[model samples]
Target: MTDTLKIALAQLNPTMGDIAGNLALLRKARAEAAARGADLVIASEMVITGYPTEDLVLKPMFLEAAESALQALALDTADGGPGMIVGGPWRQDPTARPPLYGKVYNTAYVLDGGKVTTHRTKHDLPNYGVFDEKRVFGAGPLPGPVNFRDVRLGVMVCEDMWKPDVSECLEESGAEILIVINGSPYELDKTEERIQLAVQRVNETSLPVIYVNQVGGQDELVFDGASFILNEDNGLACQLPAFEEALEVTEWYRGPAGWTCNPAHREAPAGGMEPIYGALMLGLRDYVNKNRFPGVIIGLSGGIDSALTAAVAVDALGPQRVHTVMMPSPYTSQESLDDAAEAAQLMGIGIDSVSIEPAMQAFNTMLQPILNGAAAETNAGDTTEENIQARSRGLTLMAISNKLGYMVLSTGNKSEVSVGYATLYGDMVGGFNVLKDLYKMMVFDLARWRNQVLPKGALGPAGRAIPERIITKPPSAELKPDQKDEDSLPPYAVLDDILKCLIEGEESVDAIVARGHDRELVNRVWRMLELAEYKRRQACPGVKITRRAFGKDRRYPITNAFRGPA
Candidate 1:
């Protein structure tokens, strides 16, 4: 038996639908590992087809392409002599009986010396929030262990490592080490949770675990690649960096006690708000770059929301790629205009001032004929006026987008998105919404945090990227005179708390109301959220920082009659 085995963890950022590109990356990693005399190279879950391909995996041609890619990968690794554990979609008999032969599996294939030997299917298929694996992939019945270089290794996919049953089965089958390939997405403190789980698994089975995770932004989801290896004694052996792609090579030597990993070189920790900030930056950068968008343009109102959005845009793409348009309406404040110009100048981004008064007047004048008999003093006219202003701004932004080939970014926060305070076709009109899932309170906190911990090459103002008045003053849509967000809705502190309970905690209305909230307010908020489902459904894609973001993660019916406590 070999006393030591060298293992390579390939933490790669894969682009979805790029089968050939993904395969090339896999082969490159394999070649590098082989050059280093490593025994095996382990990749992340679904590395070939990319993670969360969603319904794309169900397509026959897609599956065929994936299968072909897998064959090519196997052939590439044939002469390398180093084994590889790669994750991809596999076909089952589509026309089988009760057990269903055609059911596809979220599987990992073990290839060595040009031959595919072992295959393991994921056991615990997570169906909750952002995971629909149960609906797509079939569970595997076998819990067999694979033996390579006299080492009995247990391999499991992402969720399989989270469960005890699968780990126990592998341990019982005489597995020496547990290698888990994951496609885990990033949330606030998900890295800590993953560490705890890995430690718990090691304590349970007395086996060291090596976790390799995919890293990249996929639409709303961002996978932070902070892969690690933990010893059976529940000690941290090695940890890779977060929010970046890295190839980690570590050696495991057999000792009198058992296999002990050589002390892993740890990268600098992205502590506190760094990971979150890095996640947003990477998510935004990838979303723009991957989609082939030339540049991004945001409507800057000098408010904290737009100010923060502008800062993030400039950080994600350089100042040259970020353009700001200040669309002042009748209710626009002079202070707001000054702040907008200041922020644009500080960031060195292009700024254009376009007054909406002309467009707003034209819209009202055109509608005057149809509304000749309508009451001018009614609140309906006020509402129409506000909507027309919003729509006019949307039209102007869309025109700039069409002319300059820039993608408009919607600047609505979760507080407004949650309670339907945002105009669907107005402020919500954009190719992407950066702060859709960030609460208003969080927006303020993040702005402060950004000011304190500015990015390395930030061009924006050094301190307080957002104006102090904007953060201190009550939020307003600036649609009408004396319009404050508090006048139409609850305070952000209370609103965000209630929303966290309802949206993230999934607490019922009565449950939320029982938490010292007014029943009427809870009911109103719930109704607004329900009614705004259609709008959210049609809203632009944004990064999902929260656990229960209103994207693919939180799928709800638009026409549902379901209501919370009356």
Candidate 2:
């Protein structure tokens, strides 16, 4: 048995379903670790097939490809370099059943000496809030420690470390160190929660821990690496940066007491709006580039939502790639026009103006006769007219998107989405909505934060990317004359609080009212939230920032009749 050891935590980003590409990433990390004099390298969960995998693991061919790539990497260990602990799907029995082949597991393999020495599967499969592992993977049995180079190492997958049972079992089984591989995604203040959980495990097991996590955007989910190490005495030994790929080698020595890591790099994970903005930028960047879009074309309305969307787009893709168009109608104010142009100028992006008044007139003329027969007279203030303006802009934006092959980026916030304040095909027309999960209040907060502080890795220019006027001005859709959002919905402060209670807190009307809101208003907000389910169902995917984001995170029935107590 060796008295000294060196371990490397490889925090990396992998593309989903790109088995060969992911294998290359692992190989590179291993080589770097080996160069740094690491005995073993630990990567995050499912690094071989990217994270989540979703139903892609259901296909036998995909599993076969993943296994082949994993074996190829295992062969690389023949060079007597650092061994690897890599995550992927493992097929237990390939010829057992006709439908599923056999039980499939989320497994971690230990590759050394040109072969896989041992493997462990995930014990707990998460089923809540953006996780559907229970449907795709089989639960692993309670596991013991894996002996690597005469040292007992207790290994746990992503969700396995959430509770204490796995750690307890490992401690009782004589595991000296706890090593966890994770694909944990980012939510608000999630970094602290992870650190606390690790501390809990350390306190319970009385053994040091090495947490390795992946970093990248996978559809709606954005994984923040922020991998860390905790000493046996519950002291933080090392911390990696959040939202970035890193490889750090840690030295360990076994004395009379047990294994203890020498002091290494420690960086406080980003706090407050920094991580939120990073998640947005990274999420948007990956979605567009990974899907192979030329760029993005946004309908810049000069409102807070649209302005923020444009800034994020430019920061994510750079000004050269992001295209902005001002789709102005008769209701579009000159102030809005100026604001949009100034904001675009600050970001060094090109903006073009297209008048939608002609299309609006054509649509009104086409529908005037039918509306007159049904409602006595067609009123300009009617929702039909308002909808036509929105549709006209949507059509114009879609036309531009088709010709230029750039995806449309929508800017509607969650408050607007929850209350059905968004037009279906109008402002809601986009391949991706960056602010879909953020409330209107959060939209304002992020915009103000961006103007004050430029995020790291932002491709846009420094200084205020969004004009101060845009941040301070009253928000409007500019669909009708002198219209404010409050004319149709409650003030954002009240609306966001109530919506958060209903959506994230899952509180009833009575419970929300207890928090100083009017019971009737709470009931009305709840009713609107329920009624807008169909619209959200059709909305494009966005970055998930909240614990209970829309889409896969929250599932509500469209045709339900159940009502909460008022």
- Clash totals, every prediction: 4, 0
Worst 10 residues of 2 by lDDT: 372-381
Model 2 off-target regions past 4 Å? 96-98, 373-379
lDDT string, candidate 1, 1-566, tens digits = 78998999999988888888899999889888888888889999999999888777777777888888888777766685688999998877643333322277888888887777778888888989888887777788747688876888899999998878889999999998899999999998899899999988998999899999999888888898999999888878788988778887789998886787898867656777677767777788778887889989899998888988888888878888998999998788888888888777766777899999888767766777788834243223567788877888898999999999889999999889988888879989998888887999889988878877777445444665666676676778888876888998999899998889989998987788788999888878888888888988889988889898998779889999988433
In angstroms, the error of model 1 at 64 is: 2.1
Alpha carbon lDDT of each predicted model: 0.84, 0.90
Candidate 1, clashing residue pairs?
92-102, 93-101, 93-102, 94-102
Candidate 1 stretches greater than 4 Å from native: 93-102, 268-271, 373-380, 456-464, 508-510
**RMSD in angstroms, all models?**
2.8, 1.6
* Model 1 CA lDDT for position 138: 79
| Candidate 1 lDDT score relative to the true structure | 0.84
* Candidate 2, 208-249: lDDT as tens digits: 999999999998999989999999997889999988899999
